[model samples]
Each structure stands twice: as C-alpha cells, then as structure tokens.
Target: MRLTSLFFFFISIVVFPQKTIKTSFVKKTKLKAESIVSVTKSSNYTSLKYIDNQTLFLKLNDSIIYNYSNVQLGDITSFDAFSPLKIKLFYRDFNTVVVLDNRLAETDKVDFNVVKPYKNVSHVSTGFGNKLWVFNQDSQQLELYNYKTNQVSAKSLPIQSNLIDLKSSYSSCWLLTESYLYKYDSYGSLIYKIKNENYTTIALDYHDNILLKSANNLFYLTDYNQTIAPIEIPKLLIKQFLVTRGSLYIYDNEFLHEYQLIKD
Candidate 1:
C-alpha cells in the first residue's frame, strides 16, 4: 500500500503543470537616440542598415561615413560590421562592398563583377564566417566570396533559396525568408531551420538562438529538441527586437523593455 501510494503521488506530480512566474526586475539605464547624440541627415532619401554606439555608416550609391556623435546614416541597401573597428558596406548599383576601418577610413573595395565570374551580382548578403555569401542567379547556387583574398567558391543547394534578408551575430548567420528561419554556422554550412507558424516577429541573439514573438507569447530556441522557454513581455505590440549579450531588449511603441536571461 505504501509503494502504491508513492507511485500515485509521483505520477500526480509529473502530470501537474508547472507554474510560470512573472516577476518584475529592475530596469537598466535606457539610452535614448535623441539624448545620447544628434543626427545630421545627409540625403533627403536615406536608409539606415546598422548602428553601434560610436558611428553611423550609411550606404547610398556610395558609402557615407557619419560620426555617431553628430550625423545619421542614410539610404543604406546593406551593411555588415565586424566590429566598431571594421565594417563592410554594400552599394547595390555599383555592385561593390566597401571595407572600413575604425576611423571610417576606406580599407578596400570589393567588386563582385570581377570576383565571381559567372554569378549575377544584383543581390548580396554578408555572413559572419569571414566570407560573403552570394546568391548566384545565373548558376542557381550559393557562392562564398573570400573578401580578404578575393577568391570565390560555389556550393550547390537542393533548392533555389532567395537571399531575402540576412544578419550576422558573432559566428552565427541568419537568413530570413518569408516563412523560414535558416541558421548557418561560421563555415556557411546550414545548421537548422525554424519554420514560421504564426510568427509575428523574431530576433536572434549573438549565439544565433532565436527569440520568437508569436501571438502574445515569446519562445526561446536553444536545445536541439527545440524546447520552448516562454517569457512574459508587456501587453503591447512589439515594434523591434534587439538582443545584445544576455539582455533581450524589446522596443514597443514609445517604450522599451529589457529582460535578462535566466538559465536554470
């Protein structure tokens, strides 16, 4: 009877659902764009691709350097930054990628036309693997361009995946399609794919783990099993998601909320 009672108790505990706590945490110092610095808009039509604490580099037909202390990045088609010290800017019309040093000095210019012989240079997406992954429209394969040596290598994929959107954090790469989240390692090899099932918004941390915002719930992807760790964000429409270090920051309307990752 004792063993039977113990067995039932264990089963009951296992069957019961775990409680999710919504504990409040102290907020971090919020840095406002208007408070920290000012912007000198260069072109009437300007698009910003990336920003850090110190500089704002813009890409038009040509790359424009802005002192984050005073100017704003404008009319950018694409951009990739290795650090605050190193960056790569893509100018679509000229089919070029410009490398910049810490002081926003031109380091080198990469012309895709001469580099990848048979590939159409219309669209480009930068990867963190020290190589630029090019979608070759002519060959219908993904080509890796070595920016340092100016060498090109091609790999044949099973499907004709369009290079719709791209972003790199640390050694991980993210290629976003209309309905899929493609994860690639530092070597440009495909690692994982997370399908968008009602995914309204998404953000990637430096490690490439996805933070998915669907409906009113937040899920974190880490383990190979794809176990979801749900989080409670405020009841508002999320405008943007930015993850840096271990802090996940969400910009909703005029307010920003920061959450710290707790690993049990």
Candidate 2:
C-alpha cells in the first residue's frame, strides 16, 4: 500500500508540475488613431484597418492611408498580414478574398463560389508557400488551399464545435471554437485541443505562443509549457487586442497602445 501511494504521488507531480517563471507587460508606446477595426504589424511597418463614412481605410506607418471602396465585396471579415508584401482581406458575406500588396493595392482576388467542390469558407488566413488556410463551414473542416492551382492540397477531419476565430502562421494554424481551441500543422493534423476556458478572443504568434482574451483581461500560454499566465495592462476599456512578433497591441479610446512583454 505504501509503495502504491508513492507511485501515485510521483505520477501526480509529473502530470501537474507548475512553472515558476511569469510574464509581465511593459507599455512602450502609444499612437492616436481613428476607430480601428483591426491592426497588424510587421518589422518595417504597422497596418491599421479603420472605417470612415462607409469607406474602409488601411493606414500604414501613420504616413500613408490607402482607401478601398468596393461595395460588391461586402464587409471585411478578416485582415491578415501573412507576409510583408502580401496582405489577405477576407470577405465572408460574398465568399471572396482579396490580396493586397504592401501599399494596399489589389493584386489578386479569388471568389470561392467559382471553385470546384464549392467551399463555403467562413475563415481564411495565409498559409505556407502560396497556400491559404481556409475553414469551410459547410464541411466543418479546415483545408489547405493552393491559390495558384486553385486546389485543396490537404484537409482536416470535421471539427465538432462552431468555429469562432482563427489565426495562422506560415507553418501552423490555430482555431478557436465554441468549446475548445485547436492547433493544427500545415498538413491539417490536429496537434492539440485546449479547453476554451471562457476565452472570447484568441491569437497565435509565429512562435506558436497562444494569447487568449476574456472580456478585459488577457492571458497567454507560452510555447514552453501548458501553464496560462495573465498579462497586465493599464486601466482602459480594451476594445480589441492582438499579439504579433513578441509584442502586444491594445486599442482603446481611439488610441493604439503598444507593449513589450518580458518573460521572467
């Protein structure tokens, strides 16, 4: 009985070990901006998506703002900065996607309605090498689409929950559903499924770090462990937030605040 108790204790420690290191946020800079719909950053510039009098604007580096007025494309559902040169704008209402160059020029457009197999795509993000990761609502699965060839290279099994949000990098993708958060590789294989834990928003960085937001608070799960740590931010009603390239940006009161996170 004593030996059995010791074995179980060891198993418990191994399964539920706690990490001591903590992550903290330090405010670095703030910039005044218009009502931002979404924001993304690259090494060279920051992209801000905003609206003005029924017209949408893509502001880069606070110096140039490009205007896009296409009523036929419907509302912008997703703004993805996959590459420094190519940005993806997804329109869910019309089942269309527009690729923009760094200057926000329309370089290409794809309407999924004309594609064979007829993917009712609800979410889209840039994928590895000339591919796009798209979530098909009708099929309840994620597919890797080759835009150049207009073919689905690979697909995942049907997911059970309703997908609420999705973010992706070059090599992997993260899906936030009504019940869980799922991580998948480029081949559409499920690597992990984490419980939702009341998180309303989610973002995944290139390093595979997971950032989750619940109401006004932010939490993150580092790449090294499963432990979730809270990220402190100044007292401001956060309208939206995102994590990119080891930095966190929060939008509140018509201003975007950038913070640098240090893990200690």
TM-score of each: 0.61, 0.83
lDDT of model number 2: 0.77
- Least accurate stretch of 10 residues (summed lDDT) in model 2? 19-28
Clashing pairs for predicted structure model 2, backbone only: none
Model 1, global lDDT: 0.55
Q: Which residue runs does candidate 1 get wrong by more than 4 Å? A: 1-74, 118-130, 137-140, 153-158, 161-164, 169-171, 186-188, 198-202, 213-218, 253-256
Taking the candidates one at a time, how many backbone clashes does each contain?
3, 0
Q: Candidate 2 residues 186-238, lDDT tens each? A: 88998888899888887665478878888788888876555677876677777
Clashing pairs in 1: 46-75, 47-74, 47-75
Q: State residue 93's C-alpha deviation in candidate 2, in Å.
A: 1.0
Model 1, residue 167: displacement in angstroms? Answer: 3.0
Backbone clashes counted, model 1? 3
Alpha carbon lDDT of each predicted model: 0.55, 0.77
lDDT of 1 at 57: 43
For candidate 1, give the lDDT of residue 113. Answer: 66
